[model samples]
Target: MDERTRADVERAEAALVEHYPRLVRLTYLVLPPSTGRHRRVLTAHGLVQRALPRARLRRPDGGLPAQRGPAAEPGYDVVRLRALRLALAYEGRPLWGPAALPQVWGLRLFPRVGGAEELALDQALSAVPAPVRAALGLWHLEGLDEDAARSVLARAGVEEPDAAQRAAAQLDRETETGAAALLNSAEFDPCTVQTRPTDLLRRRQRVRAALALVAVLAVGGAAAGLLSGDGDRTGRPPTTAEQALDPGRLLRTPNEAWTDTSRVDFTAWPVRGRQAGDRELLGRALRVWAAPPADARIMTSAGTSTRPPDHPPQLLYAGQIDAVTVVVFYDGERLVRYAEPEGATPTLHFARVDDADLTSGAALVIGRGNGWMRYLLAPWVSDVGVRDLLAPAGPVHGLHVTPDAVTDRIPVPPEGGTGCGHWPAAQFRPSTRIAGTGVNPPFLLTDLNDLVPVHLTSVPPGGAPAARAGEATGTPALQGWARTACSLGTLRGAGVRSVDNWAFAGQRLPEDSGSATWVCSRADTWRGPGSVTLHFLPPTTRPAEPGRIAGRARDTAACSSFGAPVVGNVHWRAQSGKWYLLAAGSHGVGGIDATGGVRVSGHTNTLAAPAGRNAPDEVVGRLRSGGTVRALRP
Candidate 1:
């Protein structure tokens, strides 16, 4: 290790030793078991041991540079929280469940304490919900003020403080004396020092055993690629259009629509006071794909005029050259183009898009927004190669592009599904035409199959089966078709949990799924019924060595963002049935608060830092070399 890092580790270790006693006391209080006090204490010790190596020590001012090793272990509270989560997970309870049940000894369980006192205490404490119990523990046991208690509760997923206050009052009335007695009990002393060398050695061995368990369970390999900070490109970025420059507006639509008409209704509008440079950039991005005829007039962007008054006016230009349609979008530095043939896919001779292709498009132009645009092109874009499009847009970031992005064809979806809204007519074909892109997107995917399928096992509240499925209720008609097409067996295999209608609608779909694209769009009742297009989705792409990093990383000061040092937790499960905690800390390096954790695996003794920021591979490397992984179980 370098002198600086070694020094930081030494300092942190010294702090760990100094704060070890207090850390144990806090863990015992937070996770007082109904029995087995000594065992629980040992577990808490191991958790702290494991957490320290991975923790980012906060300075007195709360800024992070764990190497500083402040006199006070700002990470003490973080250790307790991590311990609480570990205890809960070990016991198979919700990590955020109510504050621990009173840690009564043998006599209490066998009824040494007065029946009245025990009953009152049990009633009061158990009655307190998770947040309230946590609050009470912090206030009465830990002596934290209302604000501090509230902050802890909030981190534990409790938003409001009123409930905690109310529970505290209840505890005061019911078992104030009993609580005092429990605190003063001989079995629960927080200040007791463990001086026995043999006992300490034995405990250390147990901690090692726990670490072994984790290492055995952890998947071993290189880490997954770095995830993107920008969310999966499901929606367009906010436009920064200037409202003051109102030369001419484009075709404003209330909602987005996709139609077969190559040429949207286009009427030439004067550029009024628009900048020549802005116009030039727009032309270049479009010319790279397919240039419109010189006579083709530019139409105002659809839906800019009525954009919310607070939102930036959007600049969009649409034009047609015979069978080809070109639409350009500009939001300051960001520029996008939607180029496609009038009714058929275009044959592009260019192998890839580059900086020279689109002058200002360098690195700034994100390609995931061009979802399914690849299908419209011949000699489809390669998963790894499509990144070339962003060369002109600047540093090209990687994203998990769907097969439809490269080719329009997919395996024939099961019977009963149909295309809805502006979706093209369904064309049943083989899946080979659209092979899966075998990499996870840095951001999450919001594909059609990701939707939760509602099964009408029982009629829903406020409506019948057909009535319950409406436009406002998220493509119920398509959902119904999905329900019919997939039997209970299929749905179960597909991970669609069937619930009563109302409850189902309120639930969220899982982050990942293996089903194909199930398109549903709103239909105009007056014009005709909506459509539901179905395409066989590719197999689910599983991370090679799947793992998660539950922590924060440094976001970019600008583009080319990397996951800098962060304080968080890492967990991994491999195909070999290994599941283990890679690291735990209050301060984590490299921010990665995404859905699936970044993939990472390696020897517990050695660590690797990622080569680039925001790259999945970078995250894996950070976790590997970021800090020492303690064998102690979380």
Candidate 2:
């Protein structure tokens, strides 16, 4: 072509190359590693390779075919948006299966996290709703601003700029709280040029199977791999940190994040093989239950040092599943649960050791579920050293043992749900993206830990559901609210009432339905103690209406001693016909006067802090005899 065209192409290619890594990561966020029905289509590396050519070449080159109506060279936002659209359109669905929801909504929910586990990029994205996922993929992962993110979502079929704005705001909250670390840590490995995706799939499977086989054999009896394997040979033996490779280093200890043990009901648990050394039994467990390749290593070691010498050592089963390195924990022949560390390397703690203790390695693994630390330790390893390395150096917590457990492996239901209800959203396909291709309402943002259902018997004009009599019931429901209260500091000294603290909670309210139940725990607002629940009904798009807001605050411990109950009415401001929840203390923390002015008390107990614009429809407010009021959002 002409020299000018050639120059434009060159500049475009350079920009593409410079942004290639981010592009790959973005594409991966839109489509992540999975073994579900969409596996063949959601080829992240492949999609990026294909979409790179369509990005606005240069600031001066104008838009590509997918991007028209743009004047000068479309910015990187346009390019990234195009790439996302391309990825979503792949294989006709981002994910597949009867349950797969558009925008990856069909997966298990990832509610608010409380610092126990470190989620990988894919895992984190899997927890987010699809629209929010897309918005975040643009904002955080792709580095787009709110306006640009709104534009990108618009192009990708999200009609409401306000919704995109809400998603962007939520992302900001997540990043501020370190919730987005997993997405930040996610990386996209370069894909070699290939003609077909099947080839890549076959190669990937074969490699995983081979490694798994080796790992199984090594854990079973062979120690050759550990001694000769490539690791830091800088003459110094590797410390726990040094030995922890990617995935492992990135992984939190069993006690860290949400472990599989968190969701299980031990009463009905199923058992696996009887003893530890039963190669056939262990192998079968690995193959079917652990879902590892036949050859992955299996090193069964008896517990020592930190535990009763006679107690069975925890069996460390290391292998590859779906190209990911994972270590499964077992009690005797029973498969308790499994963990996936990030990389391909074997964990030093779980690595197969040579020489003595072969008998212990083959002995039946046992545990009282006192705590995983003691059971997980290797024979020769020092308990103190490893514990100090794995956890923040401090007083050791006793092993969290499961007692009187009847069965072995947790049962996997028809939907592939391991008795543990929590599944990686990526792995579990749900349905299509919510409010498809339209200006859908923003999803209600409640505590990820809150499981209280918004009873749907009735809803007002803004998509918020009315609370039912039994909206908050069940162990999980209480645990959800308790965790949320704990996070918000309402239960500062009260702590979560139960161990099942967090899980995904939130709702996609219907368009035209206004009003929802919001609970502002004293902890969330840092306003003394206890929590208040209220029905938040913002003014309708048509006209402003005076609505009475009411709620109750309970379970408040220490803060209950605060003098005089705080009082306030919920209020909203109308802008462009859309109502926004006026956060408590926003109007200068005062009681609203006849002229609609607010008055603040020197020491008021408002249940909520001021919620910003784009706040959820429902919010909780506390009012006292003085007519002073404070409100918070769900």
What TM-score would candidate 2 get against the native? 0.34
Off by over 4 Å in 1: 1-16, 32-39, 53-73, 84-130, 159-162, 178-181, 190-634
Q: Write the per-residue lDDT of candidate 2 for residues 482-504, one digit (tens) a residue.
A: 22322322221221211111111
**Residue 573 in candidate 2, Cα distance off native in Å:** 22
Candidate 2 whole-model C-alpha lDDT, 0 to 1: 0.32
**For each predicted model, how many residue pairs clash, with residues at least 3 apart or on different chains?**
60, 73
Model 1 lDDT, residue 5, Cα: 37
> TM-score for every candidate vs. truth?
0.23, 0.34
Candidate 2, residue 603: lDDT: 32
lDDT of 1 by residue, 126-244 (tens): 44554555565567666778877777766655667667667676676665344655543433443442211122223334544765545433421100000111222446542223221
The deviation in Å at residue 384 for candidate 1 is 95
